[model samples]
Target: MSNIVSKSSILILGGSYFIGRKIAEVFEEYGYSVSILNRGTKPLTSLNIEQITCDRNDTECMKKALNDRRFDCVVDVSFKDSSWVENLCDTLDFETVKSFVFISTSAVYDIENLKIPFKENDKLAENKYWTSYGLEKINAEKYYTDYFASMNTRLIILRPPYIYGENNYAKRESLIFKHICESNPIIIPKTNPKLQFIYTDDLAKIINHLFKNNASGTFNVGNKKSMTARDWVNACAKVVDKKVKIIECDYKSLNRNVRDFFPFFDYDNVLDVRKINSIFNEETPIETGLSNAYKWFLDNKSQIAFKENIEKNICEILAKSN
Candidate 1:
């Protein structure tokens, strides 16, 4: 992270998963110096980036891993716990960091009476689906803002809805692909809830743009249009060039939860993208993103190990035909 290397240095907190991995690759491709700090569980084999192996919560390890290195930007991609934010910041050389970016979630918004397009200034309260997770994200944002305010370090918060694309380990896209590919019925709720999504590479581009512009503020990043469950299924189906069977059931009538049989719940969480779009508007369309995801699933199908219970549960629920 020292200026000796000469390229702009960016330190990523979690750099092995979908969003973090995409950001790392994007930065590296554009000739930026990139470094990753995370537990040595997942390896970014494709990129030859410097990786620091340590638990983020370990104060001693954090101090040793970071040392006194300085970075042009510090990106927080997987800070689910506020304590982790405090632990990392407390251990870091704040003055050495030029800017900070925290990857927040759309869950920070209250679910009830949600704005059609959720803005950054919308209400933030606990909801059943994301109560603890959302609250923790809110706290993390607060802690980072409060901590950096006194230091005058530029801080940016990005709240994104469902992040999807190639190599998504969340099973949201792959689950749909699995059902359609296997000729299994895709069960969905009667209510069609529109949800927002952001492609992995598009997000990477946005972050890179922000870094280049030295932007700092809270932003809701996603595609302007919303996609319903059927829209998602249709996109994946088109990738395979096949028509599929769909079973829409009343979610409330079922004893088991709708999420037990599906990846996304029957609810809307679309985000407003006016601010981000005004800055960087090159967004990947839903059809293109799903096609990319389908290609990745085809390549990694044999390697993907799905929970048998989830598949079986989908079948069981479809049998009742409720």
Candidate 2:
């Protein structure tokens, strides 16, 4: 069935998200039929796309939604559970699916040091039962990679460190812009710790590259250059031409509530992107991305409804733990 003129019918697992939506946009622009499997709360206007609301945790629901149809590719940006992925591998098999792309995280790498860049073959985290959110993703990647090793379904694992841009769920740019607009000083543990960041649009381009080239390996998507936390804050400030002080503080002194969830401030694992650069050389400058993100924040800040679920969930969990 594969031919030079063949177009892929792609099923994006978390197509409502920033990165997932951008990938769908790029795929549709290139004449591919894209469908999404999400919560179906977000409205999409793409004529060539369809969305099926299915909770990712429900195995029977997934099998029902996918059993009647086959997809050329499945881009899973929300596959947090290893069991779900393994079940899909067994059910879908190689005969029904061609490619599987799992959006893993660079969080799978050890970040105790801020100097070394992580390679694609670096050791994954060993502890899945503890620590940050990396373990779930790590297990999912391993399951997919091993499950598809003997099948016709080629596995592609994309590990992105930190993603920011318009329609971002992380609210990283919004957080920075809010502080900048309020003239409130941003705080960092140190001015020298570096981190990797990639804009959502740029990431979409990389996913498109994989689609065209049939790249079948684990690739890292991040800027070639790493930026210090202080530099990033200052860069955002410079982009907006806002004068705001930056407070330097120890990790321990930051609000315990915020610090408990955001422990990356104390570590940096720079990603080695030579393999990514070998394919897509056009990189979005951090300064330019900051400017665009700041503009988006300025234009849409008033429309954003702040949800307290994160705060509520954190407090509830903490209270139970105590």
Candidate 3:
């Protein structure tokens, strides 16, 4: 059995949305006292977590919220940069903290992103699509790595590919599932981009995996397999027990932004999980993850916005092209 104390405390930098919410729930289930720090936007519905409502970029607010506080583990699940990292680390009472986990994306390796599977040691560059998002994360990763080395702290950075699961705010799998559920026509590009994905719940479990094992260093956390957009749509269609009408066309060639209709970029984003899987082994297939997501959509579809304006625009573009 693993030797981590389930009762240890943790502080999540952002715990209201998809990834952070799932992680907070998992740690709480493991008996960890969970606390979340974020600008109070959404209320934490399910977990009994302590909330520190303040923007992390506000150095004074962060200091006030985290003064003299300690955590066994701290995970930055928010979209933050090196400045946020510096402010949080400076404000945190690391004297009692053991591990700090930063959620970096596979976008870090985006210059060569479409060509090959990125391992932990891959070269990071600015992604044309993700742009500055990748560069900022690389800087944050560097800062955390350098900062933690001087202390008795385990800094673990996870470079995950496109994450999908229940309550995902991103209009990815859920959007397709909704279209399929509503018997709507779905669009895709001719050169179907293959992408790697990780389940949100599995990622939450992986965070706890590192926290328990005290694992340090960066690791790619995702399923090693890759699936094209059509294959992905077909998988969602299978779960929904609905046949999908997939129209393959180069949206860009039509002078239409692909994102106006499609969810993922026009390139593959695959990650090599051998480093993290060698330790955590928390890969959940899309088939399984989509099943749960479909069930949640059925129960809470009212809560999910289908982006009607974008849908209408996509139809107009496709109709005119036809």
Candidate 4:
């Protein structure tokens, strides 16, 4: 084990989960003293990291667990409500913490009149598709900005579109991989909207880069280039070395909720990632990232939980179309 350095001390809230888990591993590998705070319900897979068991929602519990510990950076990936941010700000001592990085979503943008490749200064509104989730995230961003400004703490906010990598709880890549493995036809909406995806490891690297440099500001983070939904599905198929047919159908004709049925959401939420890319030029190609995600899904297929009944509904639609 590397000697823990005080300057590199880091705390990750909700580090037991997907994106946060990857960040914890990367920081630990880089010889940082990594500590994770979670509710202790999920299993901690990362070795040689400090674990603080406490509910982030409970202000008192958070204070008790993290009052004495001071970290150079706090990477928060589990905050959903604005109140959660308020609680964390009220409890943690910002005097010692150099930076606070929040994992925000691109859904905060108003996609109704959104321009493609949105920049950091782009106008944002509550996401219509994920109404409450987007609104709350917006609120959380405001709270963090306001509270951190008062304390003169550096704040970095990352708005990533779709984050896919190993150990993903969301059924995004796994759903497509499952159908491709079964030799089932993939169903998608007729419109081939542009989509953006950031590999979890790459996101972790971005967080680490921002912290090391003490970069502060809201930045849009994603792959350099955006691909259409059709290309994305094809990439997934190529990853598994399987040839699967894609059936694009009109959602109205199928009389089903397209967003709920398809893997990619209806909006073309691509972010202009030049700002982050300028600092760190480590953009993982779509093919390479998708291949890694497919491999992980195959290895952990049995443990993954499928949320959508896409196979049954897609097969029925295909049969009816025939």
TM-scores, one per candidate: 0.95, 0.86, 0.94, 0.95
Q: Cα lDDT of all candidates, in order?
A: 0.84, 0.73, 0.84, 0.84
TM-score of 3: 0.94
Better of 1 and 3 by TM-score: 1
**Residue lDDT tens for model 3, 1-322:** 3534557999998988889989888787777889998997998865578888999879999999998887889999896677888898788989888898999988888555445777788777887878889899988888888888899988889988889988889868888888898898788888899878888888988888787787888888887688998899999999999999888877766777778888988887787777887887856777899899899888888878878877897778669757
Report the Cα lDDT for candidate 4: 0.84
Model 1 C-alpha lDDT per residue in residues 187-235, reported as the tens digit of each score: 8878867878999898888887887787899999999888888787777
- Please provide, for model 4 over 236-304, each residue's C-alpha lDDT reduced to its tens digit, 9 standing for 90 to 100: 999989998988878886677775468767778788888888888788888888888888898999998
Q: Which stretches of model 3 miss by more than 4 angstroms? A: 1-4
Candidate 2 whole-model C-alpha lDDT, 0 to 1: 0.73
- Flag regions of model 4 displaced more than 4 Å: 1-7
List where candidate 1 sits over 4 angstroms from the true fold.
1-6
Q: Which clashing pairs does model 4 show?
A: none
Weakest lDDT window of 10 consecutive positions for candidate 3: 110-119
